[model samples]
Target: MPEPARDPRLKSLINQLQPGPVRKVKVIGFDGVDVLVQLMDAEGEEAEIGRIPLYEASMRRMDNPSELFELGQEISAEEIGRWREGQLHLSARACEIPALRSFLLSIERRQIVTGTVSEVHNFGVFVHLDGEPDGLCTGFIRVPDLTWTRMNHPSEVVAPGHRITAEVIIAETRSGQVTLSLKALREDPLIRFADQIGRVLTGPITKIIPFGVFVQLAPGVEGFLHLSELTDEPGETSDRLVDEGELITVRVAEVDLQRHRVRLCAADGEGGF
Candidate 1:
């Protein structure tokens, strides 16, 4: 069999190219987290190029880059100068474009989005938005958005790998952040508690702040008993009269639906309403 002649265009591209900042490379090889790519010239001709080190494959914590990128995957990258041995040191992470940012911004406020719980942090939950490109995680649900009721930790409402539906609360395109809220999908219990106004409700004191005692009338529904309403004592701390988890009788004095606040007074004690 006779050998076929090479394309003159491909030879010309290869001869004209020098390792500096190659773009639009295709993954031709992989080792651990490192990747070897076939660099494409301006004319889209492929030439043996360089490797992207594990550290340069992604911005996120990557145990194995191959898990995310596969052979023949086309990715843009920058060639960080050249090695003395005639190889290009590439950075694939730099190729992480703003596609996610633009997509998040295009998402309307209050738009429902489903995502898998990727991480549960002390302050919030990190969700990997569904339908988005893999490894593009920027969706966050703050602790307040995890549930309607008070939560000490995000894990109380969501665990890692839990699939959840949430509303887009804020889409910050500039910062490439999407804030989500699961609670927004539900009705506020405080609003429903309005009908309980002027009724005597017995519940446990959940918290005692300097300003008042929070009495849980129902799940996600709490009434504040201001320090002034707890006792007639001139200068007594709320802790002196109430303790968390202590059952108490209170008359719902007022329900401020607009502020999502409820005021309560002792039902029969010295501070009885």
Candidate 2:
């Protein structure tokens, strides 16, 4: 018959000194206390188990070997009780046979789940399904995927306890980690605002510098009306050109969804738009 597999900790001890007759041994010394055990024969006056002197150094703090011997004697009692409690925990974790379970308990793709937002991060939002194990339905929502607006921080888009319907981008066992998409759950303004591209859309110049003016084209999307792109009025230098919050009607020259930026031309319909 094949021998039962052994824990490495037990194996190491067995390899060092052969088990003579399978008797459990425990020893104590100064540093602290530990178990010194072996399978010993009961045939004779059971000889004291051999000591790994170095191993006993850890028991130096124990100061009383008799006390540790008392503790060792109680091992059969304490270990058994602990194992009984551990058995419940083990069964609970093991009973969840994920391999036999389906990804969706019973939901369609794109189905909205009103889950509470949790652990909002600079890059992602985590959501937890209601009433399930805390480990069950919590997932991530990347900052970029949260809204159409440029996010200086993730907290702006999500907060703990915020009920949100995030699309399940991935629900696989490999990671067992869910990838959520809040943007997919919401209506896209870009799609509706796409028509404003050919026509000039004017908004406050929220930012201005030597580079150009950043006009809010949409909540998130903005156009850079370059210093060179601004038409000069008579001898007006580019520096004297535009101030922030000044109404600017720059033609949306290009709409770049991939880069999340827009190209613009001066409102005068000139400057080689």
Candidate 3:
């Protein structure tokens, strides 16, 4: 499938913001959720007006902009593109820690980065990137990006304090984060299994969702047998026809490489699989 075109304005904004340069700005005042500021030139003279949204004020969460900045306080921030109204937008969080900004700017997409796993949660894994600023954990691997294989939990693949190398998916200065992917370094199992389409295979039912059951054809390779494919008889639910761990014969119907999905159908002479 063709990729969607990006909005011209957004594309322009990204091009302008990425690899952005840090600038000096003095807080003029607070406007509700925004911090009004005056851009400072090299000579420390005020130039243009800039605004820092509350969320961009600091890397740490805070209830108010006043928590970090005071009136007329000179601070450093990166020019993060302009709002729709042409108001200059700045990110204090991006430059709040000089080391972090340098680290985020130095990394590139698909670059190999090493880090120590600091936490493992159901949603993702957090890492203390090797070159990141002190006391900051910037590397993160989302659950799906951890590996290509199906897993019950992230702990199955990595534990706290484990050193790992991953490919950088993105280095977002706005979020002060580097999204890493361990599976990008490994071969996709589905790509290897694609050649096996149309072959008859017998495997155990690993899981049964509302739509169908997942049959493990190979380690890390599972095929989805839709509930409708379970039996020719209408009104027969999957639970009534099959049980988890039950070996069932199926034919590989399709393998979607882009989507990383495998479709299966019951083998000939089999009522359900």
RMSD of each: 17.1, 17.2, 4.0
- Compute each candidate's TM-score over C-alphas: 0.61, 0.52, 0.87
Q: Write the per-residue lDDT of candidate 2 for residues 1-273, one digit (tens) a residue.
A: 222233477345424322122223333232333233322344523334333222322212445444435433311101111122333000111112333123433333455656788777776777775434444654667777788666578898778988887775544222234556788766555555556667778888877776677888777567778776775445544457777778777888876554556778877667722
Clashing residue pairs, backbone N/CA/C < 3 A, model 3: none
Question: Which model is ahead, 1 or 3, in terms of TM-score?
Answer: 3
lDDT of 1 at 81: 48
The RMSD (Cα, Å) of candidate 2 is: 17.2
Q: What TM-score does structure 3 among the candidates reach?
A: 0.87
lDDT per residue (tens digit) for residues 1-273 in model 3: 222233577456545546577889999999997899999888988899999999889978889988878898999888887885899898988888777778898999789999999999999999999878888899999998998888999999999999999998778887889989999899888877888889999999999886689999998899999887786777777788889999988999998876788999878735453
Q: Quote the positional error of residue 180 for candidate 3 in Å.
A: 0.9
Candidate 1, 1-273: lDDT as tens digits: 222244577456433332234378999888666888888988999876788888778777768888878888898876764664988878776556557634754687678999899999898888888766566787899886677677678888989899889998666432346788898788777766777878888999999887688899998888889887776777788887778999988888887764567888777534623
lDDT accuracy of residue 4 in candidate 2? 24
Local distance difference test scores for all models: 0.75, 0.53, 0.86
User: What TM value does model 2 have?
Assistant: 0.52
CA deviation > 4 Å runs, candidate 3: 1-19, 41-45, 232-235, 269-273
Pairing residues by index, what is the TM-score of model 1?
Answer: 0.61
Model 3, residue 239: what's the lDDT?
A: 85
